[model samples]
Target: AQSVTQPDIHITVSEGASLELRCNYSYGATPYLFWYVQSPGQGLQLLLKYFSGDTLVQGIKGFEAEFKRSQSSFNLRKPSVHWSDAAEYFCALRRDYKLSFGAGTTVTVRA
Candidate 1:
């Protein structure tokens, strides 16, 4: 079984500042990892994904994540955050055609 853990339940970031969200996964083998963001009253949007090859993967909205096998982590980061970036972020692990998600981290952007 695979599970994901998002250490931060809530995060507050200043507008135009950098932001990082921690995500750790527990699985036997390397599993497909994904980061999804959901704005208020909106559906989940794919931020980035890491399956194989590159250790660092970039996605839409200037977001990127690095897959570290040693740390069992796939943390997401954005160089500069915008007010619209405020949303709930989820870390998911896919295996056997099933997806397991983390508890989620809610990001609040302030000016």
Candidate 2:
């Protein structure tokens, strides 16, 4: 089966603390890896993506991710998180013209 899975359904971190969201997938080939963040009742925002070349990619809202081809994973990380960062994170892969998304991991930042 080719799918993306997020181990944690939810995560809570203190404001100003570091955060990491795990994403694992099973695919025949390296599909286009992407991380998107969605605010409450809002559409998903592109955080980062792994197409080719570099395995590490940076994105807006102070987020970054490293693609590990051997492990079949692409994890999102932020050194310091703010309250506004509290949102849902989704790992996705381009499957044909469609995309497969993980169930999503909700992030809660405590102040």
Residues 19-75, candidate 1: write the lDDT tens digits: 999999999897799999999999999998998999999999999999999999999
Off by over 4 Å in 2: none
Q: How much lDDT does candidate 1 score?
A: 0.95
**Clash number for each model:** 0, 0
In the range 5-106, model 2's lDDT, one tens digit per residue, is: 999999999999999999998888767989999999999999989888888899998999999989999999999999999999999998788789999999
| TM-scores for the candidates | 0.97, 0.96
C-alpha local distance difference test of each model? 0.95, 0.93
lDDT of 2 at 107: 99
lDDT of 2 at 83: 97
- Cα displacement (angstroms), candidate 1, residue 93, comes to 0.2
* Candidate that scores best on TM-score: 1
